[model samples]
Target: MSSSKNTLLIILAFFSIYVIWGSTYLLNKIAVSELPPFMLASIRFITAGLLIFIIAKLMGKSLAITKRQLINTSIAGFLFLAFGNGIVVWALKYVDSGFAALEISAQPLVVLILMRVFQGKKIEMMSVLGVILGVIGIYLLVSQNEVVSKEGSILGMVMIFVCMVSWAAGSLFVGKADLPTNYFVNTGYQMLAGGLMLLVGSLLFSESWSSPNVWSEKVQWSMVLLVIFGSIVAFTSFNFLLKRVSPEKVATSTYVNPIIALGLGWYFLNEVITAQSIIAAVVLLTGVYFINTKKKLVIFSRFHK
Candidate 1:
């Protein structure tokens, strides 16, 4: 491909990742009404994993990875997909889609803090300021009676926090671990490994398959869409963007998702979008901007590693 074409492809990949992943919050809430959240996520990822694995093989990609790589990737998959994603899916049952997205939007800041602690990376002072702003935004979000009045909303918020932290840890570990040269191959294996673990968790923790609402067509199609768009296409494009763009640029998607989710909620479900919520969202996004400033610094040290 020519330089112009390569740049265009990268831009396209970034938008695809941002739009598709942002849409998953609404889809998750829709699915959870008639399906067990964990079980639905398990089915979505398992299908997506198998689809990606098949596509990779058809493209003449190797499935085999080093044992060390497999172990590391599997651990990341379990933490990020099973724990991070699972918590989000489960939280959706108790929280509004837009609120859930807003809660999890703190992920970029969390990743920065975790990287500083574990990787010995220097964090920018601006990023610390951003974290403070972001926390204040979250307090505003929770202060609203709408969120705190619900029985499980507080627990739901806690679960979403777990999702954010676990995902940060997963990303850090994946960055540290040796991964496949091919992004598709690495993603496929990780999805497969993660999906299997989620499946086990679903079976142990949920009676989804036996639930009266298990086989609803509405729920089934939602799972199908989540797999095709949310898991496979969204994630594959996102991993591609991680390599082609700066982490700060990639992190912008966290802020974007809440807007998308809010719009979808208002349009599809007639959910109310209060003024307070919008203000809180902006504060949160502003905080994220500061938090991601650390990635903008240029490093020229040969002794860094």
Candidate 2:
């Protein structure tokens, strides 16, 4: 591809991860409204993983991997998808989609703190400030009387935090784990593993299983978008941008996703955006920006050794 075309691709790829991923919060909120959360997640991931494998095969890419790689991918899959994402979807049943997205915007802050605790990595001055602001941001975001007073909303918020820890730990694990060289193959394995785990969880939880034909039209469309755009295209674009652009530049999605989620939720679902919530987003994203002020900061980009 020519330079101009390459630049265009990069721009489009960024858009995919930013807008598409940001939109997924609303999409999940929609799907989980009618479907069982675990079942919904399993269906989305399994479908995406299978589609990825098919696409890779058509591209003549190898899908073979060693046992250790498979194991690592499974671990990552559980942490990142089965538990991490699955629980968030479950939480969406009680919390607003935009609220969940805004809370997750503090992910880099959590990742930074986890690095310190697990790997003995030093928190630089800017990151320390980021962490402080992130804490305050979280408090403002979650302490809303109206939001928390809702039945089960507090538990939902707490579970979402746990999901953050799961994703942070997963990011740390993926930073060092040996996996397939091809991003598509690696993602396919991870998604499949995660999906299988979610299926097990669904059965254990006794979540009702229903056929797709029985789903509402809006939910069916939402599921389709989640599998195709949110999981596959957005995630692929994320990895692609990490390779082509600077990690810090790619990490801007961390800042953009919440705003997109908030807007979409408000417009489409009539989810209210509180004044405090808006303030929390500003502080939280600003903190994330400060955390990335250092050149080559991880920003969830394979920071572990």
Candidate 3:
């Protein structure tokens, strides 16, 4: 493919991930009303993982890899999917899905902080300012929603913060790991590993899976969409973008997702969107933009010789 084609695909992949994954917040809210949140997420990921694995194999993608690579992929998957998405699902049991999405929108800024603390990189001044603005935006959004009590809101915010940190670390680990040569194969195996961990976690945490009969059709359909569009389509496209573009660019989807979710919630679910919510969205997006666009720092190492 030409450079132009790759760029177009990259952009499309990013957009697809943003839009599809964003809508999942609303879908999850509907689904959890009728189904156990964590269990539903487990089923979605497991099914999507198997589907993607089969597709990768049929496409003749190589899945053979060293033990180290397998371990790395599993770890990344566990962190990204299990803690990232899994914990968010769990948190939704206590908070509104839209609120959760808005909170996670701070991920780009979190990534910057993680890089500084873990990777010994310097935090850019713009990112520092961006984080401040983004945090204020989050405050405005949550205040507008009033989805939980003040105390519960504080806890919910903390949970999403942990989720963001886990996700950022997982992404960085995946970038550093020597994983599958094929992007699809990597995505397949990672999802499979992550989904299984999530299933086990749900079993251990919830102690039992609720019967399907207990769920309404709306919930069931939402789970189906989560599996099809959220886990399968969005994740595969995300991995594709990872291959075609810089990770920083791919990370921009984090900011875009909240807006998409906010819009879909308002339009489809008739969720109320106040002026504060709109202002928060703008502030958060601007903050994320500053974070993602910051210039990298280059340092010489004495060991380079």
Candidate 4:
């Protein structure tokens, strides 16, 4: 690829991840109102995964994977989608979509800590400051008496925190795991694996399944958008960027997603954006910026050395 083409592709990919993905918090929130969380997620991922395979096959890409790669993708699927994403969808029933997005914005902080805990990676000074600010930001977001006092809100917030952990763990795993070389094929496997597990979860929970014809118009639209743009387009862009750019730059989605989610939720869903939520967003994104900036510096030093 020429430099110009690469730059253009990078811009497009970043837009997909930043805007489309940011909008998915609201999209999932909309769909989950009329559909069960696990069921909603399963349908979205399964449809997207199958579509990916079809697209890949049409483009003459092989979908074959080693057994170990399949297993790794399956594990990532469970961590990133089944548990991490599904439970957040479940929590949308209780929390405002904007609030949920804001909470998830702290994922980089969690990933940072998880690296230290699981891999014995040294926490640098910048990251330590990030950890401190993340704690404060999280407290500001979750400590609202009115927010948590809502029915099931506490549980929702706690479960979202768990989802963050699962997502962060999945990130760590993907960094080191052996998987398909083709990002599209790799994403397809993970989505399929995650969707299947989500189906099992829905069955285990005895959640009612309804036909799309019975779903509300808004929900149907939300599901379509989630499956197409959110899952297939934006997620593939995510994997693409992960390979093409620095990790810190890819992590910039963390800074933009919540703002987009907050705006979309407040505008479309009439979700309240409390003053404290604004404070939390600032503190949280700043912390993430500190961490990402430090990361970029570290990578630059390594490359130059």
Q: In TM-score terms, which candidate is top?
A: 4
| C-alpha TM-score for every candidate | 0.90, 0.91, 0.88, 0.93
Residues forming the 10-long window of minimal summed lDDT in candidate 3: 296-305
The TM-score of predicted model 3 comes to 0.88
Off by over 4 Å in 2: 1-13, 239-252, 294-305
Q: Per-residue alpha-carbon lDDT of model 3 for 89-116, expressed as tens digits?
A: 7677666666678788877777667767
Cα lDDT of model 2 by residue, 1-305, tens digit: 69999899888998998899899999999999999999999999999999999999999999999999999989988988999999999999999999998888777777777778887777778878888998999999998997989999999999998998887777666766787878788889988999999999999999999999999999999999999998888876765554564433555576688899999999999999999999999998888777877553554334422
Rate residue 163 of model 4 by lDDT: 94
Quantify all predictions' global Cα lDDT against the true fold.
0.78, 0.85, 0.75, 0.86
Cα lDDT tens digits for candidate 1, 146-252:
78899899999988998888877775566546877677888777788888888898889854564435467766677777888888887777666655554445666
- Per-residue lDDT for 26-76 in model 4, tens only? 999899888999999999999999999999999999999999999999998
In model 2, the worst 10-residue window by lDDT is 296-305
Comparison by lDDT, 2 against 3, better one: 2
**Cα displacement (Å) at residue 148, model 1:** 0.6
Q: Which stretches of candidate 3 lie over 4 Å from their true place?
A: 143-145, 148-151, 210-214, 294-305
